[model samples]
Target: MGNIVSCCSLDENKKYLNDDEILETFSNSEINEFKKRLKNNIQIVVLLQDGTKLPCNLQANFQEKTLCISCHQKVKNKND
Candidate 1:
């Protein structure tokens, strides 16, 4: 049998990410580029470690100080 792969670390206590935590994952230039793409309505895909490309629309949750992705369900279904 093949070993199962997990996309994210299992952390039962974790719920949501804060601003700093989210920003830390990307460089300043990358963040700027993402914002520009978001404004232009350009399509973007997140490349996963498992070699899956998940189509996403980036959005900010200011109240929560977090970033979110509105994924394309069709793409996800096809990939799965």
Candidate 2:
């Protein structure tokens, strides 16, 4: 909606970011952040190493060694 920014490549992905740094950590924080972002219509996206883009929740299990999600269906990458 905001000019349709693209996350088209794995190289464009961001470095590992822990939840404490910028994301909403607790339940209340998560709700508040979601509400605030929705209210302001802010865009939040995630680009995985394989160039797959998805809207990630505030807290996700990304503790795996490589931070990879082998998504079979993605609009950005279409791995399958």
At residue 79, give the lDDT of candidate 1: 43
RMSD to the hidden true structure, all candidates? 10.0, 13.7
If scored against the real structure, what TM-score would every candidate get? Answer: 0.35, 0.21
Across residues 1-80, which tens digit of lDDT does each residue of candidate 1 receive? 77769756877896788998888989989988877665555556988766888887777654677666777654434343
Best by lDDT: 1
Clashes of each: 0, 0
Q: Which 10-residue window in model 2 sums to the lowest lDDT?
A: 60-69
How well is each residue in 1-80 modelled by candidate 2, as lDDT tens digits? 57757767565576766878555446887877766655444445668687767664343332442222233344653556
Top candidate when judged by TM-score against the true structure: 1
Residue runs of model 1 more than 4 Å from their true location after superposition:
1-42, 74-80
